[model samples]
Target: MTTTPSLSRTDWTLILSLALLTFVLGTSEFVIVGILPDIADGLSISIATAGTLVSAFAITFAIGTPLTMSFTSHLPKRKLMLTLTAAFIVFNLFSSLAPTYGILLVLRMMTAVVTGVLISLAMLVASESVPTGKRGIAVSFIFGGFTMANVFGVPLGTFIGQRTGWETTFLLTTTLGVIAFFAVYRVVPSQLTSVKTSIADQLRLLTNPRILIAFFIPAFGFGATYVVYTYLVPILKGVLGVPVAWISPILFAYGFISIFSNMAAGKIASHNPIGRLRFVFLIQALVLAALYVTTSNVTLGLINIALMSFMAILLTTSTQIYLIDLAEKFNPDAKGLASSLMPVASNVGIGMGSALGGLVYANAPVMTLALVAGAVALVTALLTAVSHQLDQR
Candidate 1:
């Protein structure tokens, strides 16, 4: 058996460093929404088709994370993380330089898969080093990097992309990835941990009911968020009648509110995991539901966008902490699997959200997307409430 990694200043620095990587990766993953029209036009595709770029990436994350974790689980995690980040960095560079739309789509999928792995690995590292009480905060801190990505990275990238071109956003993403590579190299020491399990053994972790339920909320919750988010550009442009120039700023505003929501989630979850998360999920359902009526009025829509962004990520951070707690209590041996499962849940949500959003748009007008999203969120919250009761018992 490999010894567990002990906390060092090195771990602390790398934790923050990897968190920054997630910020850029996440921002790039979702930033296209604000500028989806430019991308669609540039590629000579319809806006609805251009939307696949979002869904495709989410699909990759849903399917790719566990396989990547299983294949690499036994290797030294530090080395694996660095290598995956480097691969991720290169893939983003490819996204920046992709000449044809086909290449860009492929590269985005590649980046998403590695991103899924990076997300899981970062959580595993956090769990390894931090004490139990502070572990949730630590994990939340790392995820906070992603939340702040909306606050800073995605909005800024959207603005830059809209001003120059969508290609520029990939450049910005590449720069962030390069900076992250070095940061992880310097700050995160190469501490290898052991896992002797075969791939089949790793799969067994998902068989546990608690783990399944633990993973379920985010899939449904974030899927709901993505249904609205994946088509935000279309909704803003088509329904709200926002002009092209204003879209970036609107997204910027949403990202800004998301930061505060992310922090508030971490702070509140520290006290009441079940109540706080459950409340956030319910509020998210309400806020998304309101978008149908509110999105008709530009002022109402943009204001509600801010409110929705704030509510969007609350479930993610809380669910992450909840998983860490559950992992420590029941499945210490499966830390890597548990850590990785969160993304699996969210990615599953992302796929469901994107697919459902796409399905709705195929038949109905854009406003229906909000209703679709709100309905999914309602289901997620209901299931989560039941799960929470089971969790309590």
Candidate 2:
């Protein structure tokens, strides 16, 4: 595709609106982690049980998203987006009022059912609304919202939860969702058409070897980061000898760096995505490996981690564009399902990597987890190379 000079104002509006919606969605999904203890205390549940909200949301998001998206593929694009956004707000509203831990857990899971689909819809809308060359930037900005949530929304929500109450965190999310809904409605075209397809049509995407391999790219790429990220606090405190007082600032800085990483991913996806992804993962693998040596020194450890954070989402935008582009080639009608794959694969990677990391952490030195994650990142590079080769054939 020929490169466009710049996105038009209208395109920017639509994309930004979608980004705002994703920021809200991202905040809702992740803010629970910071307030897990508060939630446990509020509901008289163990902290371990409160932690299940995070895992449950991720599992449901991975399993439920494609099914929900596939079944709703025929709906008008704008309506589907609005409906999902409204549903998200309603779920969060209820979540804010749940009287019991079980009720809150169920609401969080229900919220997950719509969360991934809404994010996928945002990416789909952004990609289709822009020129081909600019689609990458559009999608990246949509993903950028999540990073922004990490940078701004999650931290702010955490503060609110701590100072006020945990329930207030969901209420904050609901307020943001309401704003996002209006932004989406005002900017998104009401007549946006969708490619009509049956559930079988969407499921048939799994039969394509190219796509099957493509799905694993995000899984491995993201898994590489999550393995270590899942235990980041412990690594910082135990391995790097970082004091408790500095942890928040360090995490805030990490999230701040991730926003730039998200922007870099846009440019990578703008052309030759698979080829670029091959090297992105390779560099990421090298960075993760470096963490083994760096963890022994506080300054080096922080810098290496910042570098790792920069590499974290480098694959996300490109992988997303890759999946949607492949679907367009082999099965145009299944593009909605394709849109859902990046998030689904990402959650799968996170779950798998965290589980693997937990096992390793229990049995080996914490620094060893970085080497294991690096190996997974190398696998991501290998998969990308294979994907690029398949493209040639």
Candidate 3:
């Protein structure tokens, strides 16, 4: 509960390492989108079948995070993190060496399993390392790794694939995972031990409406963002008529904006999370709408894509902070569940957003997908307001 712990020299070392690991995990999760075609080609699979790799990771993450938290409840946070990092190293290596699509699927699923534990603990460590007033900022710093992965990792992964091969990026990330293991082992300190509880108690704590809704704000808010993002490369090339060479640069720009917006969300969240969340959704809605109209022009389309990407994750930090705060206030025992569920909800959002986009794919043009995404934002804003009103009373 003191910044003293998080700011201490050792904590910074741990934070950097944890952030780097997250960057690696985040890259693995997203690099699929960029290299989907390449993976498909290498495995002699269809694009849709290759896309299942992304779906599989989400499914595993959704089921995996809480199960991991409940099962590891008795383990020391340090031990659990180290174990997860080791698993990350192994699975990433498995993915790198995977020869067939079947093997790749299994390796990715394994990666998802460890990802659940690693991500959940990373958030908890970051939050607990700081004072309550500074929790938002600390959580922001940790998640900043995730955002940066999208910015730096995905692009770099794409570069490796373009230059050498898609497999090369996996090799690069696997090496990063090995380094992260050492970092976690050396730097991250043990958390105050928790009284172990059965899964039933964890379930009871998870059933609270506020927790469920708080989770939904994130699940759907960013879900809406992914509806467009998941297929951004296709939208850029197919609809906007941009060349392949141009798509990556636009994505890089979008990533740059996301980094700044993520920090902005932290500041705005510290003021009033609920209100800022509503404002963020509203901005996202407008930006998505603007993108739909500009899809015919490569330059204009690029600008709006960056704008929407900047605002898309604006509520992620606020939503996490809100849930953690809610859990501490009411069911103090559920903080771990609440922290772990944030990423689970995020994975769910990604699945839902992608499914929604896939549905619209048959109905209309790519630009219509942007409008569908905008609608999701509007609905999320309403839910945010409704949940706030309920909490106030």
Top candidate, metric TM-score: 2
lDDT of 3 by residue, 1-393 (tens): 533333566556656777787888898788877788888888799999998898899899889788878777767888888888888887877777789999999889888878877888888777777566666666677788899998888888888876787788788888888888888887777755554777777667677887878888888987898888878888877888888888657767888888888788777766678976777788888888778888878778878887887787778778887877887887776577777887898888988888898888778877888889999989898889888888778
For candidate 1, write residues 35-106 as lDDT tens digits: 788888777889998888987887788788878777777888888878988897788777777777799889
* 26 Cα displacement, candidate 1 (Å): 1.9
Per-candidate clashes come to 1, 0, 0
**How does model 1 fare in lDDT?**
0.78
Local lDDT at 151 for model 1: 74
Residue runs of model 2 more than 4 Å from their true location after superposition: 1-5
Best by lDDT: 2
* lDDT sort, best first: 2, 3, 1
If scored against the real structure, what TM-score would every candidate get? Answer: 0.82, 0.98, 0.91
- Enumerate residue pairs that collide in model 1: 219-349
Task: Rate residue 77 of model 2 by lDDT.
Answer: 82
lDDT of candidate 1 at residue 153, scale 0 to 100:
78
The C-alpha stretches of model 1 lying farther than 4 A from their native spots are 1-12, 31-53, 94-106, 155-171, 231-245, 292-302, 328-330, 361-372
Candidate 2 to truth, TM: 0.98
lDDT of each: 0.78, 0.92, 0.80
Cα displacement (Å) at residue 379, model 2: 0.6
